[model samples]
Structure formats: structure tokens, C-alpha cells
Target chain A: MSTPRTPTIGLFGLGAFGRLILRHLGPHFPLTVHDPVHHDSAPPERAAACDIVILAVPVAAMAETCAAIAPHLRPGTLVVDVGSVKIEPARVMQQTLPAHVQIVGTHPLFGPQSARDGITGRNIAVCPVRGRAHLRIAAFLRRVLGLRVILTTPDAHDREAAVVQGLTHLIARVLVEMEPLPGRMTTASYARLMEAIDMVRGDPPGVLAAIETANPHARPVRDRFFATAAAVARRFESGDAGGEDQRRRSRRALIG
Target chain B: MSTPRTPTIGLFGLGAFGRLILRHLGPHFPLTVHDPVHHDSAPPERAAACDIVILAVPVAAMAETCAAIAPHLRPGTLVVDVGSVKIEPARVMQQTLPAHVQIVGTHPLFGPQSARDGITGRNIAVCPVRGRAHLRIAAFLRRVLGLRVILTTPDAHDREAAVVQGLTHLIARVLVEMEPLPGRMTTASYARLMEAIDMVRGDPPGVLAAIETANPHARPVRDRFFATAAAVARRFESGDAGGEDQRRRSRRALIG
Candidate 1:
């Protein structure tokens, strides 16, 4: 049982994203994984005693995960969480983990569906919370994984995620609900919109939950979008020239 | 004039789309151009007397343009329109122009912005309203212009356009109005959404007007999109779990 503990990775939560991390990082490192709900509950301390501990649980389960792994974590161990929203998870890891343990928060700006082809050139926002260990993580993501690493603060990441992931998921869900959209007679622009929908349509429920609910900036962004849409709708309904009157005239002209 | 009339193309309306047409077709044929407002008015009669008369005007201006060109069009001449909507322009051309003049309605799916690189592999809906001249037009579009020709009737084109052009323009307009969207830390899906907006943001007011008002099927599609969006908004604002409760928990967990 003399396995060298050279840069071992202990990954928790066998969710969609957890599996993705495993598939990509498995060949490069000695990997140990545990998911209490999905996989065999390997002793928490054994998985936690690795060189790096990655929590891939939902944002809702972040607090409990941190508390469970806190005592077992070694002093120099680096802890990272891959959640859609950055600020909350960053805070949780920084506060709950031991002061000597390093913490980094990352939001892989893609899902299993979007990264289906590959993760090369995909963006990953890395927010350093407790230590400079993120520098190494960012380098590995860029050099080895062929990812685009965005070094940013947790708050800044959430600010942009409000519009980036929030609006994308929100718009995509609504558009998917309006499914059976036109397949024929599509323009270049329409095709692009469909592509955007296709990228996010199959995202897991927790991904949307973290984006729309867990992120603090998400609501304001969503509200602003809805308000703007309502204003546009009102402009059309109020008999604007390009609305009721012009529509009627256009209809009459077509028939006559 | 001693010039040979080798399939001369008479183009009207020197707007963005008209210029695109002139740039593409100018090299292939003897050209006569007239625009009452933009360029010098070369008299409607001269432009209408060519082998192919193209009306690149607004949907609202379709009837007037048709009436102006009807008196001068020769028998066996082809009259085509490049409007966003198909049914109204097709009907207007069929009704106002001389019966002997062949009427073909074309809606180029790619605009100047989208086809800036080239018009190769673009889509153009060609609906034959009066004569079989559309077959030749379709061939030329496929072979010469390298466009994909969709031979659909006026109503069928409008039905599909209502979803394609209508949704693209409406959503684009709302998104454009909400300017300064997330530029950095954007996911691939968000970038695609931005690309869709970029393609249609520069489109003229008349293009949006035609999509939202002129096309009879446009209104219902727009209404359905708005209704679907409203349902999504309602789900969030009603203190839904993924909305308020989880949001509050997320914030508290971050602090504690």
C-alpha cells in the first residue's frame, strides 16, 4: 500500500460536473472520489487527506461539505469548489476551512453539453480566496487542460455571472419551453440564437439553481431584462405606428 | 444608347440592402439605378424597363413602389422584391404590377452585416406569385450568387418567418436596448447570444417594422414569446425556492 501521494486529487460529489472533472483529470493525477448520495461513502477523512480537495456539490450543500471536510484537511492542503456562482462559495470556503489550508473558487463557464466536443479554449473563472495556490491551479488549467483562465475576484465574477450565466440560463429555459421552434427558413442570426439555446438547454437543475438563485447579482440582472422586455411589449401594445395600426394596414394591403 | 442590354438589372432603393444587391449584381449585368430619396432619381420608367427589376424598399413602401413601376414594366420582364416578409410584398406585386410582368418575391436571409464576407451559402426565399420566372431566378441564386434557394409559397414563408425573423428581431431589439452587457467572463452560450444580437443590431428600423408589424403571423409569435417570458418571471418573483428562500440562504451561508 505504498502509493506515492504525489499531487493526489480527492474529488467529492459524482454529479455531472464531477464526472467531467474526473474524465479530464483522471489520466494526469492519482484520483480518489466520493459522493455520499451517489457513490460509496469512502471515509471522509481519507478523501480529505489529499494534496488537493475539490468540492463539486451543489451550492446549497457547500456549508455542510466544508464542515465535514474541515477537520480532516491537512495544513497545506488546497481546497477548491466548482460552482456556477463565485461569491458565496468563495466566502464559505474561506470562512469554514482552516486558516492554513488554501482556498480557490472556480466557475467552469460551460456544462457537460457545451464542453461535449472538448474543454480546450473554454473559459474558467478562478477566484483566489485564502491563498495564492490559485496561481498553480490557473497554470494547470491553461497549460494542461487547454482552458482560458480568468483570474478575478469573487464579487467581480458574480457581477458578470449575473448577466453572463443568469441571462443565458433564464433566456434559454424560456426559449426551450417554447420548443418546436422553426427549423426551416432560418437566418444566420436565428441560427446563432438557436445555438446559444442548444448549449445551455441540457444543463443540470443545480446549475440553474446556482445561477438564478445562489448568485446575489442574478435577480437584479433578470429583473432588468424582464423590465426592458415589458417596456418593449408595452410600446407595441400602445398602438405605436409599428404596432397595431401598421399591422392592420399591412394586413389590409396584403389582402387588397 | 449603343450598350447591349445583356440581362440588365434595374435596382431601386439604395438603402443598406439595396447597396448589398448592387454590389453583388452590379458586376454580372448592365445596371440602371433609381432612388427617389438617396441617389439621383433616374425616373422609375428607366429602371422598370430592364430585364430584371428589383425593389429593395421597405415593406410599407412596397405598394407605392409597385404602382410607380407598373406602367413602365415590359411584358415578360421579371419584378422581384427583397423584403423581410414575403406574403404582403408578393401579393402587392401580383396585384399592382401588370399581369404580363413576372412577379417573384425574394427575402435574402443574410443581410449586409451577416454576408459581409461573402454571400456564398446564404439563404434566399423565392416565392413565385405570377409566373415560372422564379425557377430561373432560383437557379441564378443557387449557381451565380451561391445562395440556398427555398422555394416556398408566400403564406408558408410568412409562417416560418414569423418565428425566424420575428423572434430574432424582437429579442435582438430588447437585448440591444439593454446595452453594455457582460463582455468579460462570458461563457460560450452568452457569446453566441451576443453574436446573434450583433448580427441584427445594425439592421434598419424598417426591417424591424416589417418583422414585427407587416408580417401577419409575426404578432402571434411575438405574443407567445412574451407570454412564455412572463410565466418565467412569475415563477421567480413569487418567492419560489430557487428564487427567494434559496437566495436568502445563500447569502446567510456566505456570512456565517
Candidate 2:
């Protein structure tokens, strides 16, 4: 076969993450972007002609967007998604897209700030459906974007993310609700908690909702975090000797 | 009545805070130094003689040190203890010292790193037992050292510190126990926690042990923290249609 032309990138959804990708890859690749809310502000036309189509929308809108874009994609086009919850969107892409197109799901374990700042030392999980397009895309991401691509099943990706992101953010929400932060001269631990809180503080509500509601495995992890915190609290309120006794018993149980 | 001469400062406990004070005040005052461990290796004689008498030792040895140095302290000598816990040491000073020597129990909120550089803008809690030494000490601390003096009862000081320092360190101990951190890229929140852990990482074991065991108020505050964490856990674990059912039930119960 004759040499294949350089792949163009079509990005749908121009929010913070989309904007960052556009900003980073715009100068390198032809980047076309479309966001319903910001339709008039779409990326240049050259970006739309790209063979690679990236869906960078909220999880809620991912399915609808994937279905709508399937007709527009070329026969051999590779469609990839950049959303937190992978399984649902991966399934949607697989179900909606034509047989000639390839579906690859990805979740960049970072935010827009990291991407914009050119900090590429983060993990990006890839769940491929069909064709060598997934591997090609992964290679391009590695060689050009400098992302650490982790190949995994979508189910496993969602399950692990429940604990990693969901549980972490849940603990942060609880801490925020509990007490008024002391003055700046706080212990190192409290400062760390504040940092965690700050990370999740500006996240879009839909992102949290997707992780909390759409991810099938997140509830149990969130439950476990809350349970551990509650158990510690109950033991403390029971009285000094009783609390110490409970702690000792727990330690013994764990060791055994 | 004649105006009393400016009461001189006798710093007992030449650890980080003491050494810092000497570094800053050596040229200005007549400091007499005494550290059982570092008595021979202290910052040359010039910095040592600046103090009227410096008793730099552990908190546990405060009683014996006070008794031994009581004879040497002349009339109007202002002896100050820079221990973390104020109540017990303050009481020890009130009970052990001679009538001519003035005992002022002061805990500089900041530590050695704070002192070696400077003490300006930091807090110093003072529990004055006898003499107008506090006025001179407070003035010197404010003008020369730039310390913000908070005059309070020893009991009150210790009670608040039990929550501030003791509770903080307790949280650090819990977090450290949970995760073995690697030198990989971490989120902002994790970084903050690491900083807190670092602060108490190399502290004198005796200092921590004393704060944990000696402060009677510590147990309860710690207990409350655990209880709150556990309660959050229980809510998560209940699994009665996630948090929705519980929130609805609680709202109904309150309305009824």
C-alpha cells in the first residue's frame, strides 16, 4: 500500500481539558473542535479534516456526542474518548460506531492544569476495542504527547478509579464539612488535606457526579472510607480506656 | 519604691528554640548557659555568657535542673522555660524555684528553624508566676525578638495545645500508618500531608510521648476526631440506596 497520510485530529468539547489539548496540539497538528455551548468558537477548519477524532466531553454527554459524530468520521477513522469513567463511554462508542472505524477509550489521570503546563509524566489508561489503530494512537501519544499509556480493560480502569479518585474526593468532602481550618500555622497533615481539597474544589459538578453515580464500583470504596472514619470516631467517644481497648483489639485482629 | 532593673532572661532548654534565642540575643544580653548534653560543645563562650543562666535540657529533668540552679540565680533573675507543654513545667517552676528568682513559663509556638533564622511575628504564650519579669520579657520578646506574646493561664495554654499539637501529631501518625509513600508524582493534597508528616518525623520521642500521655485533654479530642471519621464511614457503608435514602429519611424525621 502507498504511504498513509499524516493523521489529523478532530476534538469535540472545548472545555478546560479540551482547550488545553487544543492549545498544546494546535501548533503541532491540525485541530478541529466543536462544543455545543461554544459552537461559534469552534477550532479552525484544518483540525476537522484530521483522521483521528477525540471526544473530550463530560461523561453525561459522551454517548450522544459519540453517536452523532459516528456518521461524520471517515471509514478508517480512529475514534477515542477522554473521560474519567471509561466503561460506559467505551461501550457507547463500540455500539454506535461503524464497523470500519476503531474505538479506543482513554482516561488521562490528570487535569487540564497538568496538561497545559506540559507535565506529561502522568498515566493515561487505554482500552482498545478493535484494529491496530489503538496501538498507533498510543504510540503517537507516547512519542508526541509524552504520556505514559497504560493498556487495561475498561472495567478494571473504572474499578480502580473508584478508589483512587472517588474515595479520595469523598474524604476531602468530609474533611471540608467537619471543622473550620485553623490559622495558617497548621500542622503538616492538615496542610496536606487542604491541598487535596483544593484539587477537587474546582472540578465541574458533572465530573464528580459521573465518578459517584456512573462508576459501578465507587459506592463500596466510598463506603469503606466513611466506615473507617466513623469507626475511629466511635472508638474515641466511648471513653479513654474503652477507646484504647478498642484500638488494641482492632490491632490484634488486624495482625492475626 | 525604686524602679526594678530590667529582669534578665535565663533560658532553660537550649535545644532548637534555646539555641536560636542565643544566636539572636547573645550580643545584647549577658546569657549564662548550661546544657548537660552539649555543655562543652555549645556555641563558643561569647554566645554562652550572654545568658544569665541557660538550663538546656529535657522537660523530664526540669525539676532537678531548677533545684540545682536555684542557688545560682541571683535576686530578680527571670528564669523562663521553653517547653512545649506548659502546665506541668510551669507548675514545677512555681514550686521548685527560690523566692528571689522569677519563674515565667513561656512556650514559643515556633521551633528551632523558627529561632535560628528569627522569631519576629511568631507567638509566645507566657504564664507568669512571680515578679514583673513578664513585662520585661514580653517587651524584649516583642521589640528585640519580634514575638507576639499571648498572656494566658498555664492550664488554659496546655489544654489548647493538647488539641493543637497533640491532635495534629495524632492525625499525622494515623495517615503515616495508612500509606507507605513512594517518591512518585503526588497531588497537592498528598504533598501537604507529607509536609506535616515531615514536621513531626524526627521530633524527640519524649516530647511526643509526653504530649500524648501527659495532656489529659488530648484523649478526648483525639477520640472526637476518630468518632467523626467513623460516623462518615458508617453512613457510606449503610448502602441503603447510597446517601439519598438516608438524607431523605433524616429530613422526614426532622420535619415530623
Each prediction's DockQ against the real complex: 0.30, 0.11
- How far out, in Å, is residue A96 in model 2? 6.7
- What does the lDDT read for residue A190 in candidate 1? 92
Residue pairs in candidate 1 whose N, alpha carbon or C atoms collide under 3 angstroms: none
For residues A169-241, could you state the per-residue lDDT of candidate 2 as single tens digits? 5555555555574443333344455666676766665566566667888876665544554454343444332
How far off is residue A166 in model 1, in Å?
A: 0.7
Q: Taking the tens digit of each residue's C-alpha lDDT, what string does model 1 give over A51-87?
A: 9999987787798889888988998999999999988
- Per-residue lDDT tens digits for candidate 2, residues B1-256, read 9995543445555555567767877777655554444546333223223324444444555676666666556665566777777777777878887787677777777655323345678777878877767886788788887778888877887777766676666655544444553324233344445666676655554455546655667676666655665665454444322446423422322200
Best by lDDT: 1
Q: Is the docking of candidate 1 incorrect, acceptable, medium or high quality?
A: acceptable
Give me candidate 2's TM-score against the actual structure. Answer: 0.65
The candidate maximizing DockQ is: 1
Residues B151-247, candidate 1: write the lDDT tens digits.
Answer: 9998999999999988888788888888878787888899999999999988876677788777889888878887897787677555352445554
